[model samples]
Target: MSSDAPVGARPPAGKTFFGHPRALSTLFLTEMWERFSFYGMRAILVLYLTAAVADGGLDLGESSANAVYGTYNAMVYLMALPGGWVADRLIGARRSVLWGGVVIAAGHYVMAIPTGWSVFAGMALIVLGTGLLKPNISTMVGDLYERDSPRRDAGFSIFYMGINLGAFIAPLITGFLGERINWHLGFGAAAVGMTFGVLQYVLGRRNLGDAGARPADPLLGADRRRALTRIGVATVILLAVLLVLLVAGWFTVDTVVNLLTVVTVLVTVGYFARILTDREISGTERSRMKAYVWLFLFAASFWLIYDQAGSVLNIFAADRTDRSLGGFTFPASWLQSVNPILIIIGAPLAAALWLKLGHRVSTPTKFAVGLVLNGLSFVLMAAAAQAAVGGDLVSPLWLVAVYAIQVAGELSLSPVGLSATTKLAPVKYASQMLGLWFLATAVGDAIGGQVARLADTWSQPVYFLTFGLASVVLGLAAVMFTRQIRHLMAGIH
Candidate 1:
């Protein structure tokens, strides 16, 4: 009903691209540029934080840097709750995407301004921007395809590849600029990427016009006006309260920030459960949503270990690994590119492997395999930690191997989960459902950051081994529940 077409009707011809709507390209490039900005900033984030005070960093100790890392990563996902809600109820996906791009561009530009407050302001803006863009973009992709279209999975796969392509290359360019020249230059480059995305989207509006139309209502303009009025008042009150809290200092910076984060997560989860209980969602749809919850748990577990590429692993590369190769010093920031590079190489092969085995294996079973593989990546990391403790430089091969394994794990679950979201989600609350999917990732990353902090408390080997063991246990338990979860997917395929 939200679509441009009448119920059960089809679009006109000449809009097809590789078996999907041509608009997929517009969405693809839009996501590509957005991710380029995001990952470009991500590549330099830890290095910027952990750099010595003389080099323009805050001179924060390892603990402070990792804590900020955790908090920042958590907030990126947390913001998606309101982002999804705003798109569903008011702005629609097109406007939300545009607004998110503007905010992100401004955030990156703010980081280029060169001040301590600029860093805080930039981070807040990026968090809000990502929440707005990330979920809405993917939901728009699903909207381009009709329900039960076989091309839907492949479309998501293609879109996901665009994400990796941006992620893979951004770090190499931005990381080099940040490390070799100026950190702000790298941030400036990210701003340019976002700006380009925004411009492309506005120019290509016709291609995406059908993808994010406002929902139709019998009351028409009256309904629209009432909704806008309500949202405007809510926004004004929320901003005023936040400004007051900041002035009063009744909440310390960290406490108030994290408290707002907790409130966001709880409210989002409650909304999704309410949807699950609604009469509009059929019994099969509820079962599939429940299955999604399990998949969410599985994903959260993987990210808990996987997100360390930025924090704990960044530390390992900087402090323990020898960057020397003959007379050349490898830039520490460049090391962040390893996982994305591996994703580029391994994602295709993993997809092929899944295609070969998909008929024989269920999705939950494949997800279990992904968890086990992810755990093994950390087992290798633990071995690297052991080598470091003994004063031996870890072979770069160990890092490459770990990255390869993690990418393999990612390929197993990431595309499957994206496709499952579209299949399982009821058409009415499509963006909201995907928002919950992303919220799971946010929760996972937050918990992972906390777990990554264990490296600061105990020995690195203990931290690594504990995560590995937890993955193995959770993976097996997930495998045990596969039959029940698969029952939920009965009508979806």
Candidate 2:
């Protein structure tokens, strides 16, 4: 799928905005609006559920709310596997993203109806839509560059900025609408944001050109057909097993959650094992791949905490923080902007730090540092929880502090981890490798949702403390293992 055309391969021959192509602007705005819809809806979901039944919520208990939240977050990430596959094998990335946006917009609109089943259905559609949009958009960014282009990292950074910008603004807009008028109104606002993104993508289709091209059909030849048959057989066997488990009363929601977690972990481990066992892999490559696996686990742990921005953090801000400013109490939904707002402020400083220290530290080392920073953010949150003891309002500054620190950790780790993944992936399985990375995040977010649901009758302080200690311990352990990883990444960069 290498393009002979030089259209988006270079910097568009001679444009002058940071020396990048204008198509970057189109993609940036599109991603911004998409994230606006996502983060905005996420900001209100838990609050809506737990908001007294008198206030029109289904009034789900803590565990149930958290369970649903976990399942929804987890499934969103899982669906990305099929989403990426469809983009690679069926429709191109552009089309997949466009259709995905439509699906998500509908989901949000359904959510605005304020019904129980509609909430479930809306969440499902949003999950599926995100699965379609998230992976394809990033892949399209990579497509904007030719192989070995230096601008790729910078382009991704710019794109990441778009993510924060949307995330930063979404809470302010939707949170206000939700808390002040009706929660459904906020959901409606998110739908409007997604609608704008879909329209932008349509208008900018020419700018995208053939960035997301479909691969040749794998079912065309007999050899491919046989391979596909084996895959289908395996799928059938797995489904049959699941059905048996459900009938046997072993497939409760908890069981399904555990099963999904186990299956995803096993598959990821198997992929790594295969790579390591293969004699074809050079020793250096093996070392680096091992490092990549460690980074994966580290990232998984970090997100297990970080993804709480939606579930746990939302409740904390709503219940504990002093939303009162002068005469009026601010909407709790506005607190959802904390993470993204911090990212917007801190990302530039972070980008500058990387540039300054690029030669001093390896990517794996940066990841190690990032995990520690992320762990520290939780510690700060625990302190906030401690301060909020005995039903008194704690300062919102504590929340702000936690967000700032976590954003720092995100800057250090996320992009670098993705960069490392690309470098270490075997050439033949590049797309699959990226899929696995995204999948790990899905697993982590699902776990975060579960953690978020623990607020019912549990002391929120204890929860934050437990999570904080766990993250710090894991971060330190990852740092201790950094030498081996450094050896792995020695030649890749």
Candidate 3:
């Protein structure tokens, strides 16, 4: 029953969602509930990991928990590369999204089981599912408009709002359920959210005219058989290696995390090498790709600090922040809601600001702004950590202010980076470029997870200040290279 129209074909002129295609509403809601499930579980993951065993938790140490959080995130994003490949060469974006949603829902339901092993098993499934779902859905969003359509950015802006709205609401509900009630129940709620997403996506498929109807580049006959065989062999080899490690007693959590971090970095280097050395791309495109490398580093740096909201900062919120209001103490996870709400409020304003500024401001300059603001947020966190030195609880407002600043930085860089990725991508690698963008986050979270171990060994103030200042210095350095980067960008704005 799926439409077989070519990709990017406009939907039949009928009812619309805010003057765009009706299908946008479908994709928007699907992404919204998917994010709801994601952020809901994320709000409580670290807290659940580090809580007392008596409190129905794993009771993992702080450093280990943070490391797990970072690795899990890295894996989720890292999978995007293969996920994109699958969509392009096998199932197409439409089916990938549907199957991904089902797997995600199943993963959350698995976590709802009250067992020590279930959480890790559930996280593995979610990582695979998210890998399939995330990038393809965004690709579908892009497919809704023709290339170079003015409405393309506006459509993505609306879609971005959906993401924030879900994120804004999820922590409030899941934080209360997980922290004040049973952690499993919170996971169950996330499962329900994803189920709703899946059901609605199925129901709304008709609205999607031809967007992601089939693979962009399908492998045929012998090629398909060969590809499947190779995938099977690789999976078997990976499993065999893991089994050997487990049998040899070297299959520790930290070891696995460290190994994956290295793998993520190597993959990034390889991907960049493949793109840069491709003889097919024109000189102008190659120049733009070179500029993209700088932006990628800037984005990776931004996420390294920004993504800690769910790990290191989440722990600080639980242990050091005062959540008491009148007679009742609020859950620490509730504070995680701050950044998204601010994003929801600030995104439009930032968009308008960018529109007004027009070509006067370059992408590198915007990225530098994001980097500086991200560092300043951490610098502020350093002060907050210092205040909590003697076991004194700081006001919840400190975290709020921190998240607000981070949101501003996110606004400055994230959307800009996405736009830049599309603009700079070589024509042949267009579909895979989004996956490369996600890899930046994978690199940051992977390395940042390792870096976060320092928090366990160093004073809180020192830890925050060190990374904070380092980011600020990197941002300033980026500013110095702005003109050079723009020159490398060739004609891209």
> Best candidate per TM-score, number?
3
Which digits, one per residue and each the tens of the lDDT, describe model 2 over residues 111-228? 9897766887788789889888888887777777776688877887889889999998998999888877888899999999999998988887666645664432323467657756
How well is each residue in 66-177 modelled by candidate 1, as lDDT tens digits? 7577768878887887777677666766788888999999999999887767777898899888888887787677677676677777887788778877887788788878
RMSD of each: 3.5, 3.7, 2.3
- TM-score of model number 2: 0.87
Q: Evaluate all candidate structures by whole-model CA lDDT and list the values in order.
A: 0.76, 0.76, 0.90
Per-residue C-alpha lDDT of model 3 across residues 42-74, encoded as one tens digit per residue: 999999999999999999888988888888889
List the lowest-lDDT window of 10 residues for candidate 3: 1-10
Q: For model 2, which pairs clash?
A: 288-488
Error of 3 at 190 (Å): 0.7
